[model samples]
Target: MASRAGLPVATAHRLTGELVSWGALQRSGQDYLIGHRIWQLGLLAPAHQGFAELAAPYMQDVLFVTQNVVNLFILDNDQVLLLERMSGTRVGAPIPARR
Candidate 1:
């Protein structure tokens, strides 16, 4: 995305460092990804994960009644981290474990 945005490599690197310092980004090997601290902070925000956790039981009840899937998502910045995701499913998703 930075490349697409025409961001200079040096500027991108410096920006990434700032984000990491703020706990908004995590650095792994040579790449950057969402930091766990962000998730920890989300748990503290009343309007976000805090409320979601509180209402989860009710939401689960409704999903059970309707036989539907329940999904929860947390938003984060756009940075790919060096990590591996292993699953039974096979797809062409990019794997950054080699970073």
Candidate 2:
């Protein structure tokens, strides 16, 4: 991580420790993760929520009728984004998000 960030190893270690202390990040074995604090802050802005809200009622109807997982995707340039998903009561297969 230090190499990727172009910071000295010791400096990166100290900074990462501080971030963890402040709940901005969490340590998961050898990996660092964005913590609950960051996720909570992000919920405040809620980018792309307008379209999602408009589609939500229809999505709910579809879920009610099909009783299956429904996902919404939008093509942005070369990438396709999963903007919304509605799954029935059961937990289906996991679909992880990627950048």
Evaluate model 2: give its TM-score: 0.63
Q: lDDT of all predictions, in order shown? A: 0.60, 0.81
lDDT of 1 by residue, 1-95 (tens): 36966898888878878889998898889777778787677556656646566667766664554444444444448742221122222244333
Instruction: Quote model 1's TM-score.
Output: 0.41
Which ranges of candidate 1 are over 4 A from the true structure? Answer: 40-55, 58-99
Best by TM-score: 2
What TM-score does each of the candidates earn? Answer: 0.41, 0.63
Please list all clashing residue pairs in model 2, or write none if there are none. none
Tens-place lDDT digits, model 2, residues 1-99: 899999999999999999899999999998999887876675565665876888899999878766678887778799776678887764564444557
> Total clashing residue pairs per candidate?
0, 0
- The residue-level lDDT of candidate 2 at 39 comes to 65
Clashing pairs in 1: none
Work out how many backbone clashes candidate 2 has: 0
